[model samples]
Target: MTSSPEPTYTWGTTSEINSFIRHLNKSHRILALCGAGLSAPSGIPTFKGSGSYWKNHKAAALSHPETFEANPGLVWSYFAERRRLALCAEPNKAPRALAQVARKRKGFVCLTQNVDGLSQRAGHPKERLFELHGSLMDIKCSNKECDYIDKENFAEPICPALAGDPEQPSSFSFSAKRTFTTQRRDATLSTKPSRTNAHEEYKYKREPNPLEALLESLSPTITPEMRQVVIPESELPHCPKCDSLLRPGVVWFGEALSKPMFDEINAWIEKEKKLDLMLVIGTMAEVYPAARFVHLAKEKGARVAIINLDAEHTGGIGLGKNDWMFGGDVEEVLEVLFEGVLLNG
Candidate 1:
């Protein structure tokens, strides 16, 4: 069978975006693919490029399956802090706009790489939304034999010990270049160190990576006293059904997405012949499998549009004749698209 001729795409200004959205409202089979940048306006940290760190550790170091296996307590502490923050974050205008449009449009699907439930919080229907990476709010048993999975667990750590506690005088420095203060697990003391502190306090010219420092502290050269900072296994979350440990339900580095989710995405592709509009929002399209979807959508004759901060979107390799690229703050660009449109009327 012959495929349709490729449509011509225009590089658009905010006004042009608004005009496109006006036309989009009358169209069917819209798909929005979202990433961590979608929630950045709500003060959530993204895991792309430099300057994106969580608890002074590179997010990649903390979000690996091997890291979890090596130090479950550390992994638990990290995710617990993430969940605590996510619970307080409200859905921003961008996702809410998508949700409102989905309500008025038919054959709308939202696929998000973010584990945060912001889209759902904004009233996107669960049936139409697929969180490609599993949600942080979901917890599953770590036991290979157990098939236990719990949704919306909202689990928090109970007085989990910190390896950087000041009183213990561990080998690692807690603060970047300031007097280290101890933070209690009960919300006492400040969590973030002052960024403007003078650099003289550091023991070395460059600060050590927190995860590497952690490993060094754990080595046999360290005295027995420093080991006390580690959290005991019992302090972490455990599976209720089998008494095994529980881990975050997110798809970690070096791990495959759940088979059911992979199958579901495949099924979605088959069901929609004309995925006329494909919105790749907030993600850099750097990861595998998920990154391939852009090519797949284009091959299926979908008009691909990318909205991200990365320079690659402006113009680079593999860009087709019918591919729109918008480089800007996702929320701001989306506001331009939805303003006086679905958001207002």
Candidate 2:
């Protein structure tokens, strides 16, 4: 087979990528698989890249059932904070370009690993785009028994325990002077309690000072009455009949990808009319099953183009043979490609 000519522009430059866009316009079916890097320019940090925020914490601890079993409240809190962060971030230019391409093209599908829902926000047709990792904007009941899946604004009220008890209060109050430190690996932050019970005595020490006096000296920073929210095994949300705690619907580490989701993707790929080209943007191309799609597309004789900051062309997929690998910021590279070739065409 004759190899495609190598385009001669530096990655992320407009000059060379425009040539590539011209190449893409000839194809009818285009499939794009996006990853965290695509959203980096929109202020969303890449999940596993250099300077990624998740580098410090153990990802397993946050997503595994074992960790949630040990402390569901803690896990929920962590995810809630993540939801807040995602809400604040906006979709970048890459998604906008993908959306534009999808609108103009007859057969375009986008499969994304990001949970930020930016692709949809960028005006991509929801029917044509698939979120492989699920979404951060959605919330489901922690009780397996309850079918309480609902759309939530980032600032929803926590379960009562998380909010603390209003009726019965504890003598031991939280100190305002407490400071928190976030883990470097994941988005988890640890707050150190100021007071620890030195004596094994379960009872509060009788220091004869009135509660009012204690309250007066305390800094306004501390909310003494606040109780830590903990999801107990006994109270785990469950199916009404089965009584199971409904857990977060996210795909966790070491867990198999959802079968139905896999089926949908496979069906799309298996259509009699094979794709004309496959565009992989912003991914390291390391993860499973998703990575296999590119290989399958290439096997079926579809041209492949990869755009990423740090990507490797493993599996002997030669770049010269109807394949191009461009490395750099996805947004900038796409801007150049779209403006110079796609839009102009």
Candidate 3:
């Protein structure tokens, strides 16, 4: 016998959405999966849309081991710009609602693919929140030999050594109070023959030459006669202990999700036996492992609700009864989705 098609819901009225929200709040074990879309309402751009930053340049091009290996400066410059932008962004209503529910309810948990810490900024505790893709706020030593990861490192801007030029050293700027220094490697003021653009070096996938590497280790300074002066390796921000390059603490396209985070999610699914509800907010369910959560929740008998700006691409993705779609501004829709649920408390 053939099976029937899965049913999907699209609520049209406030009352209906409120009714669902009421039902949703009644769920004992709630799992929420959030993505880049969750931060769009906060003026941040998503990764795969028209206005997305990644659309202009292939995301895979700049975020990879090869790119970092070719020119650590370029990679660091890109991530430093991301860090700069994230520092200026604030959490929107969607995050606020998720945080409120997670905090108010007993069995609420969140798994997010965002590097931005908007969820945490919206008041979700670190323990209850699992950033499966890692975070921009966290910095890790790039040296494979060093096991140093600093969660407190919120430092911004490319180091002067890696700064582009005088006019646009980088999209961001670093704090002067924090001096760039290292004890592992000796650095001195030096110069070499001029060469190709740093951006082109990666665009063509060419290995950086010895002089370029040495220049990359020099800090940039601006003087009246010279637009930008190149200082020494003493200016590159290196790991305090190992004195290696510091990289953004994010799970790149080829990297695995955090082991602890994966364990926690698996344990939750195994322990609960029946996950009551799965709230998928703002994501298109594109990437893996984490992307499979919706299906897993459905298999485990949990109702799934997806809220995104576009619904056409989401409805046919194996959703079932009690699986609904809310297509609109996440903040506006969430205002109604959580109305009576929060007010009644």
Best by lDDT: 3
Question: For residues 1-345, what per-residue lDDT tens digits would candidate 3 score against the true structure?
Answer: 999853222323444475567677678888899876688666554534222222133344456665555556555656666676677788988899888887777688899988888899899977789998888888888887898988946555546554334465333222111111110011111332122221121111111122332232233221232212223335656898888877788876556677877888888787867888888887767556887877788888888788765544573356766667665456766777777667764
Candidate 2 CA-lDDT value = 0.58
If scored against the real structure, what TM-score would every candidate get?
A: 0.73, 0.68, 0.73
Candidate 1 lDDT tens digits, 1-345? 999853211223434465467656655777788886688677565543333344445556667766666677767766766676577689988898888877776577888988888998899988888888889889888887998988876645433442233353322123311211111111121222222221121121221222343243232232233223345788776888998988888887666777887688768877867667778887766555777666666666677777754423322226566556665556666766656547544
Instruction: State which candidate, 1 or 2, has the greater lDDT.
Output: 1
Ranking by TM-score: 3, 1, 2
The best candidate by TM-score is: 3
Alpha-carbon runs more than 4 Å astray in model 3: 1-11, 14-16, 52-56, 157-235
lDDT, residue 315, candidate 3:
32
lDDT-based ranking: 3, 1, 2
TM-score of 1: 0.73
lDDT of each: 0.62, 0.58, 0.63
Clashing pairs in 1: none
Clashing pairs in 3: 161-218, 221-229
